[model samples]
Target: MNSNIDLKELWAKQETGIPDTKDLVKRVASFKRAHLKQVIYANILLLLVAVFIVLVWYYFQPEYITTKSGIVLIILAILAYLFSYNQSIPLLLKSSYEMSSADYLQQLLSLKRKQQFLEGIMTNLYFILLSTGLFLYMIEYTMRMKLPLGIFCYGITAGWIAFNWFYIKPKTIRKQREKIDGLINKFHLLTEQLTEKK
Candidate 1:
């Protein structure tokens, strides 16, 4: 009984390392701003690339229905991705300062779910559309070129696309999930510490 009391006293005196509410709020706000900027930059870059691809199709005019259909599908895919991205950004960037800790936590969880859905389902769809589009687009182009040159071009494009889809994209998604989960945990701990009796 005496040891238990001493342990309690010791724990009470220990610095928990959890920042005060205001500091935590500030930190979270800062993270939100940075994250929002990254999202916006990525979206804008992708939108520009999509436009560039469409422009190329309009000007160069690949000589097959498949090529035209491919370009259209690629445009559709990018637009769909952009729409989903825009919808989720507002949910993620809404200020949490005015919210109670519980509400804020709930918001974070919802944002995480939305992110997972986007990264998992939407990302896969985007890549599928991209691959199929490129394949269809290449059909006519490949026929006009020398056999060796055509093989080389197809081989390089396929390799690069495979590398991005199988490696880089999944790695990026995993890192994002980890970062969000870490933030959620930190906020959870901070809230618990703040609410606990000394």
Candidate 2:
């Protein structure tokens, strides 16, 4: 109704301190870098654990073939987890800081979906593999031990595994999803702000 208003002139005079799209993208890039570093550290730790397991198997050389197979399974699971994790980090790091708001939002959403999949399906698979591998490896050793000792060992092992699968994993997944969802919402809001008329 205000035909006399010069919209373009008003827009040109708009405040400069509003959230800059490039700055948002830079923030996202920094987040990705931090996440990548965590991933690298976690993968390295996993590799070290795998190496330790292999060393134990090599030096001990349990008489049962099942024990050897269990060790192999554990190694395979670790390698699989590493490969899956490495695939995502490079993709995440590829998001350009100069990307437009809409493009960056799309990237963020895609990354969120990928993260959910990783946290849900891949995580479950990894834990399952670990639990099974450990069970198989422990079977021969447990059988040779006295009944009370075997019960105590298996009880502690089962308790720890249960705690991880039921509590730690779900809590971790929830936190991860919350973080990514928060980022996604932030990007959406930023995009809206960028697109809004002054």
Candidate 3:
């Protein structure tokens, strides 16, 4: 009876270091809202760009088959990316409040996995299609220009694409990964604490 009392006293005194449940839930909900906003903004921007491209194609009416093919490819790339990216919306829309901690953790893990696939394979595919489309699309316009002007145009475009692929993309992916990973780690710690309490 003395030892039991001592154990209970020690347990009561020890710092579990777990955050308040309400606070944790609030943080998770905040992240979800932020993520949803990001997705919405991205989708809107991409759709606007696609519409602009279609208008350009319709108005300009390029003579070259290559230019037409390039337009098609660019539009396809955007659509395919949007399709894949939007797949996460349903998962994101599910309320965290309705889920058990373990279930929520599993959802987060699944989200992380989906994000990895998007950032990895889907990203590569999008870039490849976009680059190829741009190159092809530029050919007819560049051919009509003087040699020096054509060279300059190609050079500028290539440099911009290279910068986006090499620098901007990696930085964006790193930031996104850090945000999601941080949330996953927090939930993991929470789950561990809950398990210990039992």
Candidate 4:
């Protein structure tokens, strides 16, 4: 029964060739499984570090850090870590798309622009986040007014730099967004082709 379904024949036709119903279902399921495996492997070390954090907090926190401040510090650390890592989920998922379509080498080559476009969006999002963080940090610092004038000025300057990086980082945002937009169009084409094949 499996021998009857030819993936190449289905993929090539652009009409009625991209495998039978069952095969397509199986292929999508396989793709999802592969994606999950990649996510797990990609974060294996991160998972270990998280495990280590819990173990350390449980076993070796010193007397100085035993108070509420220590627990607050731990929570902040985990939140910061999660926020940064979550940003890369798409890129992580995308590694598969890199090697997923082996036979479609030319098509694969064509996906560079899409990849670049996605990256730009992601980068822009990162900058926006950073700028926001800096703005809040500045607010907190100014509210306290406890630091020396030099340190206060430095914090504001860093915030300005972060704002620039978010919106005006030379070359990166423009290039990445444009490239990914182009790729999105190509992906639309691919989806259309797949639909036609079906």
Q: After superposition, how far is residue 196 of candidate 3 from its true place, in Å?
A: 5.9
> How far does residue 149 in candidate 4 sit from its true spot (Å)?
2.3
Q: Write the per-residue lDDT of candidate 1 for residues 110-194, one digit (tens) a residue.
A: 6767666776677678777888888788878998999999999999989988997899778877886787678767767766775
lDDT of each: 0.80, 0.82, 0.81, 0.56
Which stretches of candidate 1 lie above 4 Å from their native place? 1-44, 95-99, 187-198
lDDT of 1 at 9: 98
Question: Which of 2 and 4 is the better model by TM-score?
Answer: 2
Off by over 4 Å in 2: 1-40, 97-99, 191-198
What TM-score would you give candidate 3 relative to the actual structure?
0.69
Between candidates 2 and 4, the one scoring higher on lDDT is: 2
TM-score of each: 0.66, 0.71, 0.69, 0.34
Over the stretch 1-198, how does candidate 4's per-residue lDDT look in tens digits?
665578766777785545678998898999889877866664675557657656655785534423324344444444444444454455434444344443353354445554554455555565554444434434443544656874767666786776577547756667656666666667667766656776
Q: After superposition, how far is residue 65 of candidate 3 from its true place, in Å?
A: 2.5
When superposed on Cα atoms, how far off is each prediction in RMSD?
6.7, 5.8, 6.2, 12.0
Query: With candidate 1 superimposed using the best TM-score fit, by how many Å does residue 157's alpha carbon deviate from the native?
Result: 1.1
What's the true lDDT of residue 47 in model 1? 87
Q: How many steric overlaps are in each model, in order?
A: 0, 0, 0, 4
